[model samples]
Target: MTSVKEQEATRRLMVFLQEWDSAHKVARSHILDNFIKSNDSKTEPELELEFSQGASLFLARLAAWLRMTYTYSTCLRKLLRSIGIFLSAASGHRYLIEFLEIGDVLILLEILGLNYHKEEDKRESVKLLQLIADAGRKYKELICESYGVQSLAKFLATSNSAEAQEDTQILLDSLGHSNPKYQNQVYKGLIAVLPCASPRAQQLALQTLRVMQDVVGEAPTAVVEPVLGVLRSTHLQVQHEAIQLLKVLMAHQVRPALLEGLVAFLTPSCRKELTFCSETAADTATLGLKEPKLVYTQQAAAAKIVGVLAKESAEVAEELIQMKVVHGLMVAVGNLDHVASQRYASISLEYFVHMFPFLEECVKNALGDTLFQHFMDSPETWYTKMDPLQAEELASIVIDIP
Candidate 1:
C-alpha cells in the first residue's frame, strides 16, 4: 500500500535520525524538510502521502529521541516544535491518545521544568499537557501523578506571559474539578499563587479558587492570611471574590484570625496597611473611617462580612462586640457621602445592636435617635448590595447626629 516516494522519504528520515547527534544541524534540516509540512518543499499531496505512511513511526522515534535528551538543546527544541506542529494539525486531536500512549505526557511535563527554555517551549508543553488532560479523566489524573499540581502551580505563578497564565488557570481549573485524589493538592497550589506579585495572576488564582471551594471542603489555616491579605486589594473584584471564598473557608480554627482580620479593617490604621489594588479601592486594614470615599468601599465590604458572620453565630457576635466593631460601624454609618459604605456599615451595626442590645444607648448616642430609628426601620438601607444614590438627591435617611 506504499508508494516509492513515501518509502524513499521515510528511509531518508530514518537515516537522518541515526546520525542526528554528530551532524545535528544537517540531520535536523533533513528531518524537518522530509516530515514537517512547512519545512518540506514537497507538494501537499506528496507530503500528506508520506506522513500517512509513517506518522506513527516518525512520532514514536521523535518521542524516543525527545525522552533521551534531558536538557534543552537546539536539536531538542526543533524536535519539540515539530511534534507540536503534528499535534496542532487539523486532525491533530486524533493523535492525542497515541501521544499519551507514547509517554509524551510526562515528557512534556518534564520540559516545563526546564526554565532556561523559551517561554514558547514551556507554553507548548502546557498546550500538550492540555490536550492530554482534555482527552479524559484518566489522562487528567495521569497529569496529577506526574507531580502536575506543583508544576502547574509554579508555572502559573512564574509565567511572564498573561496568555500563558490564563491557559495555566484553565488547566488548573479543569484539573481541580474532577481529580478527587488531587483536589486538595490543587487547592494548596492555587493558594500559593494568591500572594504572587501579579494582580492578574492573583485574580486568575482566585477565580479558580472560587470554583474549587465546595469541592475542596473546609480550607486549611494556611489559606487565612493570604485571603485576608487579598481583602486589602484595591481591586473590587478581588475583594469581592476573597469575600466569597471566605464564606466557604470558614472553620473554627480559622475564625480567630478571620474575625481579627475583619475587625482590623475597621480599625483606624487602614491606610497604613492599605495596598493599592484599584483606583477606587480603600484601605481595609487600619485606615479607620475618615480616610476617603475609597476607604468607604473597603469598610463597607468588611462590615458586610462582619454582619454575615455575626448573623450566623452568636458566639461570633459576642467576639465582635468585644473587638468594638461598633466604633468602625458607627464611623461608616456617619459617612453620608458614600451611601454604599453607609448601607453595609449600618447592616453590621444592626447585628451588634440587635444581638447585644446593651450597645443600643451607645448606638443612639452615635447616630442620634432619629437616624437610629430610620436605620432600624429602613427597608433600602438594612441589607446588601445597595445602589449608589443619585448625584442630585441624598437618602432621606441622612441626618447629622446632634
Candidate 2:
C-alpha cells in the first residue's frame, strides 16, 4: 500500500492534471491534439510519443494513484469518470481494460454492493457498471469471467434501486454482446433475480430476455420456463410484464409442454378476463365484487390477452365475442371514476368493435333489448365527456347495426 503522504501527493497530482489546461502551453497542446487527430496508422507511435512527451510523468503518476486509491474513495471514482471520457483512446482503452483486469473490477463490484446500504452511492455504482459494461463489451471473454459479472448479478439479485436494475440490464446486454458463452450466465442471473426483483426490474429483465432470445436464435427451454413462472408472480406488474414475454415464447413456438404450463400459469382472473365467456353464461357475470382494483386490473390484462389471442386462436376470439365484453365494459363505464374506468372501458370497446364482427348479437343477448333500450335511452348517462372514445365506439356499434 502506498503511504498516506504518498496518497495525498497522488491526490494532489490528480487535481493538478484536472486543472492543467493545455492552453497554458499551446505548442504542447497542439502537438498532443495533432498526434491524436493523425489518421496515419503509423501515428500510433507518434501518438504514444506525444502522449508521453510532457504528460507522461503526470499520466504515470495518475495511473499509479488510480491503482493505489481504494475503489471506495471519492477521488478515485471521479478519476474513473475522467478516464471514461478517453476510453476511445486506443492506448487509454487498453490501459483501462488492463486496470479492470487487475482488481479494478473487484473494487467496482464492491461499490455496487454498497448500493443496498447507501442510496446516494447507487448512482456511482451504476456509472461504474456502465463504464465496465461499455468497455467490457469489447472484451467479453474477460468480462464474463471478471468479478464484475458476479458483483453485477448479486447486485441485480438484491438491489431495489430502479437505476441499479436498469444498469444491471445494460450490463447483461453487454455480456450478451460479448459472447454466446455468457448467454447462460446472463440467463442464470436473470432467473435468480426474477422472484425477488422489483416490478421495474422484472420488466427490464423480460426486455433483456427478448433481445437475448433474438440474438441467440432461441433461448433455452430452461430460460423460458423461469420467465413463464413470472406470470404466476404475486406482483401485478410482473403479471402484466409477463404477458408480452409469454407471447414471445408462444410465438417462438415453444414446446407443447412448456406452452401448456405457461397457459396453466396464467392467473385465473387473467384467463377469465381474456376468454370473456358469455355474459349470460352465469359464470361470466357471476364474477361478484372481488377486489375492485383487481377487477380493473383483471379487465385490463384480459383485454390485452384477448387482443393477442384474437390474432392466434379463433376459438378464444369466438369465446370473447360470446362473453359480451362490450356490454360488460359499457356497464363498467357507469360504475367507477370517470378517468381511469372510462379509459379501460373505452379500450374494451375498441377491442370489442374491432375484433368481433358479431358484436350486436352478443350485446343483445347479454344485455336484453329492454336493458339495451334503457342504456340507449339513457344517452345522456353515456354522454360523460370522460369517455369520448366510448361514445365513438358506441356510435360505431349502432351504425354497424343493419
Name the candidate that leads on lDDT. 1
- Model 1 lDDT tens row, 206-272: 8888788788877688877677666655566676677667665564367777777777665423433
Residue-pair clashes per prediction, in order, are: 7, 1
Residue 188 of candidate 2: its Cα lDDT? 65
Q: Estimated TM-score per prediction?
A: 0.65, 0.54
Clash pairs (backbone) in predicted model 1: 234-277, 268-286, 269-286, 269-287, 270-286, 270-287, 271-287
Give me the candidate number with maximum TM-score: 1
Clashing pairs in 2: 277-323
Please, what's the RMSD in Å of model 2? 11.6
State residue 372's C-alpha deviation in candidate 2, in Å: 6.9
Residues forming the 10-long window of minimal summed lDDT in candidate 2: 276-285
> What global local distance difference test value does model 1 have?
0.67
